[model samples]
Every structure is written in structure tokens, then in C-alpha cells.
Target: MSQIRLYDTTLRDGTQAEDISFLVADKVRIAEMLDDLGIHYIEGGWPGSNPKDIAFFKEIRNISLKQAKIAAFGSTRRARVKPEDDDNIRTLIQAEPDTITIFGKSWDFHVREALRISLEQNLELINDSLVYLKQHVGEVIYDAEHFFDGYKANPAYALQTLKAAADADVDCIVLCDTNGGSLPFEIADIIDDVRKHISTPLGIHAHNDSECAVANSLTAVEHGAVHVQGTINGFGERCGNANLCSIAPALTLKMNRPCMTEDQLRQLRIASRTVYELANLVPNKHQPYVGNSAFAHKGGVHVSAIQRHPETYEHIRPEKVGNLTRVLVSDLSGRSNILAKAEQFNIDLDSKDPVTQEILETIKNLENQGFQFEGAEASFELMMRRALGTLRHFFSVLGFRVIDTKRHGDDNPLSEATIQVKVGGKIEHTAAEGRGPVNALDHALRKALEKFYPQLKQMKLLDYKVRVLPAGRGTASITRVLIESGDKNSRWGTVGVSDNIIDASYQALIDAIQYKLVQDYAADKKE
Candidate 1:
């Protein structure tokens, strides 16, 4: 089988995305993660661009990488400057990376319009920079920026650019769709034409402007390119770059090419989520392979089909990408869907059981009332337990009160909450203050429950989300709150809905605490 190299530019190109910035530590962490994923090249950053990147290079030198070669990214020498005299080239050498990737203008339009340099000078810069880097670096990869658009406009000049890099003995010539506007057919044809002119190993770096970055990269590989350049989760400037998370599996499982080992491929989901976590961005749950909803089935027909033969609905096993198949319960679900869900929960429920039909009706009714259980599996499970007459009593809420007061000249209002709860036949009353009414209520409730169940300290609210359901009554619309709660070992989401926001938040919070106690109760029974 042919081997295609996975080159990750998350630390460099991926960070160019708006609202996506990483600290020096985050950069090093992601680099190590990429190496563990068995990537061929990990572009650390553009060392000469900023102090943060330079610090990254300095810091990364101390850590040892196993599989990937650390690369420093830069541009060709400036107009009319010798390669040896350019500060950018000199700084790249100082970084002392295993590979040096320098991008040179491949389009005649960019040479004249962007760089304001004659075509001949641009070619000399490309040749001189690659040759100079090759002398100091173990391997040098030349990035032909905007090569596809350039070729479409002036084929001769584009070919001339690749020829210059090939003559310089660069290890590989990477064709870049910088604008990301090229179609898959154009990429395939252009790569074929470039191969006819030069014998150099070819690579692809595509953007997602036209939403074809992954398609373009695959097309290039199908044609002749052996190296794929992309970012995790497709993050980059504008629309983003080609997503290696998508590209890796396609090359390995579908195309019969080896990009990473099976073991490394299994780590793709964790690595993808880690990058999004470090960037403080929400993971895209609907992403191609590794997303939470990737192999999830909601419709009755799809669920029944998948239960019989997963291949009927899924292209690949979810476990292959570190994700698992999910059978979501909704109004559209059928008896088969209920049975499948029951099987996942280890509950014994037959398809013909009256409770199964009752649960289905309940789900449809609750959904009509603005209660979505799709993302709140804990609440759904709790409902099942109650319907099955297996729910254990943890605590019972007696009453609760919240007060918000604003003093003269104080812009912020002080929120205070008092709660009374009965835990194991004893009533506990507690009060607390917080920045907001919801926080105050949470503090007060947890305070009342802590003395009875000390394990409450181990659990805390991770996230709280609120949504207003559409209603003709406008401001009187019902509100729904989803609370994400976590203990040290795991996290679960619970939801509640009410006309009052505070009431909705309180309901969700109660569910969260009850869920934790139920887990403790189960653990105790197991012991």
C-alpha cells in the first residue's frame, strides 16, 4: 500500500483562525499530541513572526518527540534581497527545526500585485530560499502559495515556480490553495500537470473557503501527492484549512493508504477534542468522523436498520475513530429505538411492553412542551428509572426562596437564596449569597445537602445553558435550562423547563444533584 504523510499545521496555520489563540504551553502540548498521533510533520509556528512563536521554538527544543519532525514555517526571501541576507531565513535557521517550510508566490498576479516584484525576481527568491534552507536543514519543503489559481491564470509561470523549487533540491513541493476557491477537479488536473513538468515529490495544502479543502486534498493525493497538510478540526483563517481528522481516516480506511497506525488513528477523536479544548472553543459535535453525533441515529428507520447491521446506516464503525454509536430518543423514535436505548442502559424492556409505548408518548408530549431530552441523557435516564419503579430517593425539596436587592449607587444587585431540604427524614435549612440568583440558589442547595451527603463536594456544575422557547406570549415564553454537572470521573447533562427562568434553573440544578446521589447509591449497592 502507498504511504501518505500526515502533516499537521494546527500550531501554525490553525491558530490563524479568529478567536483561536494558544499560549506557548498549549502550542507545546499540541505538538506532543500530534507526534503521538504519528504525524509526519508538525509545524510548530512561524518563529520570525512573533515572540510567542520564537518562545515556542525555544521551549519545544527541550521536549523529545517520537514520530513527527518539528518544522519552522516562513516565507521566501524579500524582493531584491539575497537569501543569506534575509532576516526571516536567518531566524528560521536559528529555530533549528528538523524541516524548514518556506512559502513562495506561485502566481504571476501575486508577484506583481501583492509583492510588487517582477516574475523573474520572485522565481529567484523561491530558488534561493529553498537552496539556502536545504544547506542548513535536514529537509526543506517548498510551499507554492496560490499555485492552483496561479496555474489557472498563467500555467507557464506556475510551472516555472515549481521548476525553480525542484531545481533547488527541495524535498517536496506543496501546492497551496491559499484562497481555497479551487474545485476538486481543478486540483486533480493541476497536480497531474505539475507532475508532468517536475519529478519532485508533491504535497497539498488546501483551505476550506469553497468547503472543498478535504475534497481537494483527497483529489491531490488520488492523483499523485503523497503529503497532506491540514489542521485539526479544520481550523484556520477564514473558513479554515483541510481537516486532518477527516483526511486521515479517508486515506487509511477508504483509500487503502497508510497515514497513521491503527493505534494512532484511534486517538484522533481525543486529539481533535483536546485542540478545541486548549483553544477554549466548543467542539463541533457534528464534525465528520470524530464528532459526538457522527454515528448517532435518531430516526426509527435508521436506528432499526443500524441495530440489525450498522453498515446499513454507518460507513465505518464509530469505535475505529474513538467515537461510539448513539441511539437518541426523540418523538420520531419507534419501539425499536426504545429497545435499543434500553439495551444501552442495561434495562430489560420489551418492544411490546405498554411502558415502552407510554414512554414514547411522554417523550413526544415533553418535546411539544419545550423539553428536549436529546442533549440531556441524564434526565431521560432518570425518567426511565422512575417509570420502571427503580428510582432511589436521595433528597426531597421542601421549599426555596431567592431575594435580589440593589443598594443606591451600586450597579450590581446582591442575590441571596434560602433552601429547606429533607435528607433521610431530617430537614436542613441553609442560605447563601452569590453573584446571581441562580448561583445563590445553587450555593444554598448544595450547602444544605453537603452535611448529609459529603460526596456532594466532589461534584460541581460545569456549565449552565438557557434557551427561551418560542411562544405567542413573547416575554412570558417558557425557558429551558441545561446543566452540565461533573464528578472527578465523569460528566452528565440534565435539563428542566418552566415559565420562570429561576424555576427552570432550580429544576435543572436539583436534577444534577440527584443524579450524583444516584451514582453514589449505585456504587454503594455494587460494593
Candidate 2:
């Protein structure tokens, strides 16, 4: 099998995703990780787009990547403009990436309507753009914007667009499913047709509007595409682009196509998670391949089957992609599930222990009250500790009160909280002001406890997420708060649920703090 080149456009196209933004530091960090993951090319955003992108190109030039070539993305020169004179093309040259990718119109509709130029002029633009870039860069990848749609509308014109690049001796011509509406079979047939027309190496850049980006991309490869362009976790503008996490495993494990090395393939989940973490996005628990639920077993039968023969219920070994098999405790879970979860936490308990049964019943009861332990592993661990009589009572919250006030039409509202806590039989009271009620509560609680345990200073809240269980449940519905806390070494997530939003947040916040203290106690014992 021939090796497929993986081109990640997360810094470029992936940033087009709503709410996704990256600083120069983030782009450099992600590029390094992608290189470490054995990606062949990393599209380091368009050099002419924004100041941040420009800064990224400047900064990335200093870092020496081991395996991947950095590509700067831009569009072909305008219809009437000379490629050398075009500002976008000039910027790409200035960025000095050895590889440059530029998109030109393949659709006749775009030629006649979007670019408002004759068909001949569009072909000239494509030729001139690649011809000019070829001189400055070692390799030029020509992306045919809306290529599949163009081919469907006017195959002759689409073929002409690719022919222009091939005539200019471009290294690669990418067929882009820009609108993301093309199906897998359609993409396969079109790629077959495209292969018949152009001898240049073909690539596929697909979007996920039809939820077939990964399938379409894979189909294109199976048909003959040598290059695959996508983003981590399928992040892009509308539905998203093809997910490289899904594509890489499918290609390497299923198709027998070599994309990354065996070691690099194992780093898929870590890379996916790192990208999500840097983007401040909550990972999709159910995302295929790298998601939290990808290998998680909930049903008793499935868990039992997995324990006996993992291949019976699993498609692949969980560790193959740097993931682990998760046996969640729920109403549907059996003794095997409890034992598995306990083993992960290194708890010594037999499946037949009365305490294990009690914990299972408690989980079921709490889940009945809309508490999901699956997403809140820390909270579940703490619950088990409490049940098993090993829980460390770091501190007890006596009570907390929040006061909000705004005077004289002031734009900023004042939030204050007074907290009362009992630490090892000593009572401490503290009051603090913060930007919000939760912030105030956090400040007051920390202030009261920091004196007793200075190690609390090392831990801080990393992220806070709140979700109302069901949509349209209104203000009276139950709210679940998941708080992510981290110190110098590790991070943990704890969950809290309540009808009152603040109370839910408080529960998560306290759990986060207590979890930190528990770690401290365990470390002390180890010492």
C-alpha cells in the first residue's frame, strides 16, 4: 500500500469553525504536535488573512519541525492581476513556507458569477497563480474551490481548471467538497473520473454537512486520492470538515494504507485531546475513535462480553489508539462493571463486597435524580471513597450566602459572598467580592480554607461548564455543573447537580477543592 500524505488545516480552515480562534502561540504548539503525530503537512493559516496568522508564520519560522512541511494557504491571483503583483500571492512568498496551497475557481458558476470573469480568464488565473508560486516554493498544491460541484455542473470546465494546474506542472490538484453536501459514492465516482482526466496526484478536502466527510474522504482515497486534507476532531465552519482522527485510524487500521507510523497512530487520541484542550472546547464524549465513549461500556452484557473476550464487543483494542476501556457504573451495570471501575482507581474491593452493591444502588439512585456519574468521574470516585470509609474529610461547608447589588444605574454589579467552613473542628468565616456569584463563592471559600491548607493555592479552577438536563426545561429545571480543576501536575473534573444553579456550581466547586485536598492527603501518606 502506498503512503497517504495527511494535511491538517486546523490552523487555517479549522479556525473558520465558530468560536475557534488561536493565538500565534497556539498555532505553533499545535503545529509541533501535528508534526510529532507524523502529519505530512500542516497548513499554517493564510499568510495574508489576519495579523495573528501573519504573526504565526513569523513565529513558526523559528521552530525547527522534525517531519512535517509547513504549508501557507491562500487563494489564486485575481482574474486580471498578475500573480507576482497579487498581494496574497506576495504574502505567501514572504511567509517563505516551502509548500504553498492556493484555491482557484473550478465551478463555471463561480467563474461567471463569483469572479465575474470569462472561463478563459479563470483558467489563466489558475495557471498564472501556480506558475508563479512554483518558482518561489518547492511544491504547490492547487485546491479547486467547489471542485465536485463544478464537475457535476460542468465537467469540461472543471477538468480544464485542473488541467491548468497540471499544465503549469503543479505538484498536486486537490478536489474540494467545499459545500460538504457530496455523498461518499458520488465522491468516489467523481474521483474516479478525475483520476481518468488528470495524472497529477489527487487530494480530497471534504466538509461534514452531509455527515459523510470522513466517508467521502476515505472513498476518494480508495478511488485514488493520495493526499487527505482535514482538521482534528472534524472542526470547521458549518457542520465541520472530515475528522482526521476518524480518517487516520480507518486508513491505517482498516484500509491497510500507511498514513502515520505505528507509534504516531497510537498518539491519535492524545493529539485530538490536546487540540480540543487548547481550543478551550469541550470534547465530544461520543465522537468516534477518540471520544470518551468510544470504548466505554455501560450495558451489563456488553461489559461481561468485553471482560471475557474484548473482541466480542469491541472493534479494536482500546490501547491501540491510546484510549482505555471504560466500564461505567449505572443502573444497567453489573458487578463486573463496578469491579472494573474500582480497579481503574486502584481500590481494593471484590465484586461481591456488600459495599460494592451499596455503591451500585447509590449510583442508580443518584442517576434517577438526574445525576450522571459518567461525565463526572471525580465525583463518582469521591462517592466510592465515602461509601468505602476511605474518604478524606478535608473540610465541611457550614453555609454560604451571596449578595448582589447595583446602585445608581452602575454598569457593573457588585457580587459578594460570605462563607462559613469547619476545618478539623476549627471554624473559619470569610467574606469576599468577585465578578459573579460563583466567583464570589469561590473567593470566599478559598479565603477561608487557604490558611489551613496552603497547598490549596496550587489548585485553581481550569474550566466551568453548566448544562440544563433537557432543553426547554426553563429556569426551574435541574442544572448540572462540571468543574475542571488542576494543579501543577494533573487535572480532574467533578460534577454537581441541583435545581438551583448556584447550588449546583457550589457542589462542583467544593468537590474540586476537596479532590485537591484528598490528593494532598494521599501524597502525604505515600511520603
Candidate 3:
């Protein structure tokens, strides 16, 4: 197999996903990241569509990309308009990209119903647009929109469309599964047949409506397609486009087709996460290859086997894609799970020790009470350290009180919190006001502790989530709270459970503070 070209459409088709939008600066940063990852082509947005896209094209030109060729996307000329006269075609040249990619109607149904043009007129549109772009741009790619459906509807006309692009001397012709409804067998069969007629290099662009975008792209490659187009994290309209995160690895590791260097492949998770962060969206932890849970082992049997040999459970090494294997502790965990987690935290433990068994039983009981430790490893670590008599007592909470008052004509209630804590026999009491009860409590706690531990001032509560366990009981349900806290250096998660929401929040907040202090104490001891 030849080296497959990796083309990224995250900036163009990815933005079509619902609730996904990026600033111009975000696009530039993503482009630079993609280039660093060894992408062959980076498709910027259609310059004629929106001002933001136009600005992205303008901003990206100033940045020096390492390896990728920037391509501007647009549609072919309208039904009878000359290619030079069409605004969309003109904007592609104005964007000043190294390459131009234009999509033309390939399905007879789309040409007749969508474009409302005759069959011969559509052919003329494809030929005229590509021929004109080839004259101005150094490279031009032709995307056959709905190519699979078009081939199924009228194979002769689909071949004719490719013939038009081929005669224009385009760089590569990409077949798009625009509706994302085709299966792998159909994709393989169609590409097999298309290869017999078109001499130009072929590419595959798939969408995930039927949840086969990744499979379809792989199938096409197996059948001799050279170029693969997809978005990072599979961001696109409706079901999303093919995920390059999965495709890139499958090609390099499984198919024996080298699309990127091993080092560049290691940055896969970082690139996937960076795009999600810029989009302001929570990442799908279940996503393949780059997700947090991708290599995590939960069952005791699986954990034991993986500890002996990672290949027993993992398809490939997690570090190959910048991910790590994690052992989660819960009611289902056994001695092996405890040992593995101890190894991860760099805490020495013997599996035969009775304390290990005791800790395991405590975790099972806690999980039975709805205290989950999968996402709150910090809390679990502190518990283990306390059981082992290795944890330090930074401070003890004496008590805390929060009050909310509402009066007539007041749109919002006033919240205040009073906190008392004892640090090494010194009592500190403080009061603070905030927008809400939780915020007030946080402020009061910090104020009381900052005098002794000034480092606490650098910590911020990044996220807080509450889940009511065994729902339908309404106010009587047990509430589980998870708090994410971060300083300038790192972040950690702590969890708490209680019937009272305030008490649950307080428990989680206490764990967060204690974990930070413990980390600082350990660093000081090492020094």
C-alpha cells in the first residue's frame, strides 16, 4: 500500500456541527496544531460563505505552517455562469491558499432537484470550475458531492463527472458520502468500479450518519483510495464526519500504511483535546483511541490480565497515542486493582497485606453508598493514605453555616457563609458574601485558611457537578457532588455524597483543599 495522504477538514465541515463555532484565532491555532501533526492538507473554510471564514483564510496566511498545504473550499460555478465571473470561484483565488477544493453536484437527483440544472450543464460546471482553478492555484482538488448515491443511481453519469474533473487536470478527485448513509461493502464496491475508469488519484470523504464513516474510509483505503479526508474528533453536521483520530492510527498501526511519523502520532490525543477545548465542548470520554476511558480497565479480571501483559486487553499501547492506562477502584475491584492503583500513585503496597484487604472492603462499602471513585481519584488516594497512616492533618473544620435571605422587591437572595477551622491549635474564623450559598462557603473557607496556608489563594474551583442517586425520590434522594480544583500547576477531582446538598458540597470542597495541601506537603518533604 502507498503512503495515504491525510487531509483535515475540521475547520470547514467540522464547524457545521451543532453548537460548534470557533473564533478566527481559534482556527489559526488549530491549523498550526494540525500542521505540526503532519497533516498533508488543511481545508480552511469556504471563503465566500462567511466573514469569519474569510478572516480565517487571511489570518492563517501569516502563520508559517510546517508541512501542510492550506486549501480553500468553495462550490463550483452556478449553472451558466462563467467560472471567472462566479463570486464563489473568485473568492477561492482571493483567499490565496496553496490549493483550492470545490464540490460539484454528482448525483443526477441533486443536479436536477437541488441545482435545477440539466445533466450536461452540471458536467460543464465541474469542468469549467476546475479548469479555471487549475490555472490560478498551484493545486486543485475536486470533491464529487454524493458520489456514492450518484453512482448507485446512475453509474454512467457518475463516471462522466469524474471524467470531467480528470480532463481538467485536477490534483485529486474525492468521493463524498454526503448523506453518510452508505455501508462499507457498498463503498468498497463503488471505489473498485470507479478505479477502472478514472486515472487520477482517488480520495474518500465519509460522514457518520449511519455510524460507518470510519469503517467506510478504511474500506475505501483497502480498495486503493489514496487520500483520506476527515475532521478531528469527528466534528461535523448531524452525525459528524469520519474521525481522523481513529483513521490515522488504524492506517499507521494496523494497515501498514504510514501516514505520519510515530512521534507525530503521539500527539493525537493533544490535538483531539485542543480542538474540543477551543470549541468549548465537553469531550466524549467514550471516543476511541484518544478518550480518557479508551484504555481504562475497570473489571478485576481485565486489570489483572493487563498488568501481566497490556496486549491482553489493549489493542495497542496507550502511549502510542499520548494516552495512559488507568485502573479504576469501585465495588467491583479486587486486590489486583488496589495494587495497580497503588503503583500508579507511586505508593508502595503489598497485595498480601491485611491493610490492602481492609481498604478494598471500605471502598466496596463506600461505593454501595453511592460514593463513586472512578472520577475522584484524589479522594480515593487520600482515603488510602489515611488508612495507611501516611497522611498529614493540615486543618480540621470546626463548623460552617450558610444563610440565604430574600426580601420584597429583591430579585436575588443574599447569601452569606461563616466558617471556623483549627490549624495547629490556632482558630481561624471568617465570614464572606457571595452570589450563591456554595460560592459564599468557598469564599469563607478560603479566607479562613489563607492566613496559614497562603498557597490556598492560588487554587480555584474549576467545576462542580451534582447527581441525585436513585432518582424519583425528589428531595429525599442522596446527592453526590464532584468538585474539580486547579492551581497554576495541576488539577484534581474530589467527590462527596450526602442527603443534604450543602453537606455534600462541603465534603467535596474539604477533600479538594486537603488534597492540595497534601501535595504541597509532599513536595516540601522531598525538598
TM per candidate comes to 0.98, 0.91, 0.99
Model 3 per-residue lDDT tens digits across residues 1-527? 56899999999999999999999999999999999999999998999999999999889888999889999999999887898899999999999999899999889999999999899999998998999999999999999999999999999999999999999999899999999999999999999999999989999999999999999999999999999999999999999999999999999999999899999999999999999999999889989999999999889999999999999999999999999999999998989999999998888999999989999999999998889998899999999998999889999999999999987675799999999999998999899998889899999999999999999999999999999999678899999999999999988999999998889899999999999999998889899
TM for candidate 3 is 0.99
Report model 1's TM-score to 2 decimal places: 0.98
Q: Which run of 10 residues does model 2 get worst, by summed lDDT? A: 368-377
lDDT of every predicted structure (CA atoms): 0.92, 0.91, 0.94
lDDT at 120, model 1: 94
lDDT of 2 by residue, 1-527 (tens): 55899999999999999999988899999999999999999999898988898898889889999989999999999777798899999999999896999999999998999889999999998998899899888999999999999999999989999999999999888999999999998998888888888999999999999999999999999999999999999999999999999999999898999798889988999999999989999899898888889999999888888999999888988787888898887778777887788888888988768998898889889888778877678888899899999997788999999998887595788999999999998999899999999999999999999999999999988888898988466889989888889999888888888999899999988888888888888889899
| lDDT of model 3 at position 220 | 95
Off by over 4 Å in 3: none
Q: Write the per-residue lDDT of candidate 1 for residues 81-103, one digit (tens) a residue.
A: 89889999999999989999999
Cα deviation at 340, candidate 2, in Å, is: 1.4
